[model samples]
Target: MKRIHDSLIVQTMSRLLIPLAQLFALYVLFFGQYGPGGGFVAGVIWTTSMILTFLVFGLKSPQGRLVEKVLHGDGVGLIIFVGVGGLCLIGGGEFLNYANLEIPGLDAPARRYMGILLGQIGVAVDVAVTGISIVLSLAYHDIEQEYHV
Candidate 1:
């Protein structure tokens, strides 16, 4: 419940760095289809940002707002994954059948690509949320246990 850094230089640098770090992580996550990065690497990057925020600014600091949102949206990740799967099912195929989805003004291949992108996003979110939760649990177990009761 305290800002861990003592120096103004560290704090100012952190404010500039964390958001940029998170943006780069998200770029990796979203652009995975065209290049090398994917959900796993992006999730790790995202988790690193959360852990770094917690370390530099402490859990109660305003700098951790993004991490707090990630914590609260854990279930949302699951819902997104399931909902995408359900979309495949509703599109007249088995669960997660990306090829069967139909989109207006697009061919089957385009729909397939869209489905793949959506699936990747869902997985990325789920993995990132899970990683963030695990980090928080391990790092702040004592605080959580003390407060949740």
Candidate 2:
């Protein structure tokens, strides 16, 4: 079977669509809490775009290198997610309670909003990185089998 990266049409469409998909993912990430989408949906959208790029451009592509650079971001995301809850504890509230998040300039409602947003961002980052890592590992396994490495 022919590899997907050999198709010029697919390459062109992927190059065009990847950025748009990422932008839409951001839109979903931010506005999701207010409406129909959320962190999980945003993460899936972003990961799908990365997967499309990987399939169309191969593992040596620039975007693939970028993914490698960010492979450790899952830990950072987890930290952010946990840190928000920790902040709530510091503010004299129970774990994961957004209402008690204390910021110097924000009132209770604003602090809660910020806490929720931060938690969502953390979840999105974790999910995106985890998904990309899985895809990369699978691709590496395929390459190893092909080359008997």
In Å, residue 98's CA in model 1 sits off its true spot by: 1.1
Backbone clashes in candidate 1 total 0
lDDT of each residue in 1-149, candidate 2, tens digit only: 12447877878888899999999999999997789888888988999898887777755667866766767686777899999999999999999998888888888889888998999998898889899888877777664553453
Instruction: Write model 1 residue lDDT over 52-96, tens digit each, in one string.
Output: 787777665666665767787786766876887888788888887
Q: Pick the candidate with the highest TM-score.
A: 2
Which pairs of residues clash in candidate 2, taking residues 3 or more apart in a chain or in different chains? none
**How good is model 1 by TM-score?**
0.84
Worst 10 residues of 2 by lDDT: 140-149
Q: Estimate each model's TM-score.
A: 0.84, 0.88
lDDT of each: 0.76, 0.82
